[model samples]
Target: MKKLQLIGLILVLAISYQCKDAKKETQETMSDEVEATEVIVEEVVDVEIITFKMEPKSESMVQGEVTFTESDGMVSMSAVLSGLTEGEHAIHIHEKADCSSDDGKSTGGHWNPTHEPHGKWGAVEGYHKGDIGNFTADEEGNAVVEFETDQWCLGCDDENKNIVGKAVIVHQGVDDFTSQPSGAAGPRVSCTGIIN
Candidate 1:
């Protein structure tokens, strides 16, 4: 009887130890799963977008819409325009967001926060921050201009990179890329104020 009782006690202890070990393993697994869930939640990012309309300037019938999208430290601009002459034209970001004047000169000169000279967008010699070059209008007088850059921002703290208080100007002629000040891109045909 004593031997039987001793054997039974040993069996109970062994079973209890295994149950405790199993519970500990389950708790550890639960902790690891929680950490993985937290890591996944931290990887999300935010995107910002702004859209505005472009009006005719300098007695031209040109009109359009401009959109700016910011994502992962990069800004993209898309402009859809109509009522243009069927040929190449110049587009740029001017210093001020004001478009009150009939000639679009109220927006001031090209956006040159860095005081760089006029040239191509990525010219080795020099280039203004607003030197966006040129795009062609289709036979139907409709054009879609798309540009992307990490050098510009929307409603950001950096004054040199922020584009909120600026203007989009579509010129009637092509950008020579060698002219000083404003690239001699001809009359501003379309204008839009980029307000925050």
Candidate 2:
């Protein structure tokens, strides 16, 4: 009877050890599969990249370069600007590509293909497609703007939401996010045309 009991215990211990080993192998295999899938997905979702070079206007020292990436039907914009005062500055997209004027007015008013009223970017009502809100500069006269939106498109397929060939403007004052014709964002200090 003692020998039989010892044999039974040994068999149970062996089965338990085998089960743990099998579970570990399965977990490792699953982990490998997940990593492989992630790589494939990253390869499939290629982003479309576009760039712009800003020019100073009206004797202002403001200038910068901005890059826009389109992915998954969304556009992400990043800019590094310099020679700005230490305060918030409003930025928007204008109707034309021309920035020949000294005051940046040659770019025209805010891009408003939809003919909508001027308001904040995320406003539920009465907001222009060009309303990009504002960004703040540090004491060193430098500012970085990073924003993303699904409302704007890179190509010119949709006239109202298309940003390609339009002008980007950086204002001299903060965007109040209210008021008419551009949130009273003040004068255009920097301007650039977006292109592929």
Task: Give the number of the best model, judged by TM-score.
Answer: 1
- Among all candidates shown, the one with the greatest lDDT: 1
Candidate 2 lDDT, 36-96, residue by residue in tens: 9999899667778888889998788999998998887889999899999898999998989
Going through the candidates in the order shown, the clash numbers are 0, 0
Model 1 scores a C-alpha lDDT of 0.95
Sequence-dependent TM-score of model 1: 0.79
Where does candidate 1 stray beyond 4 Å?
A: 1-45
Tens-place lDDT per residue, model 1, 73-144, is: 999999999999999999999999999999999999999999988999999988999999999999999999
Q: In candidate 2, where is summed lDDT lowest over 10 consecutive residues? A: 152-161
> What lDDT does the true structure give each of the candidates?
0.95, 0.89
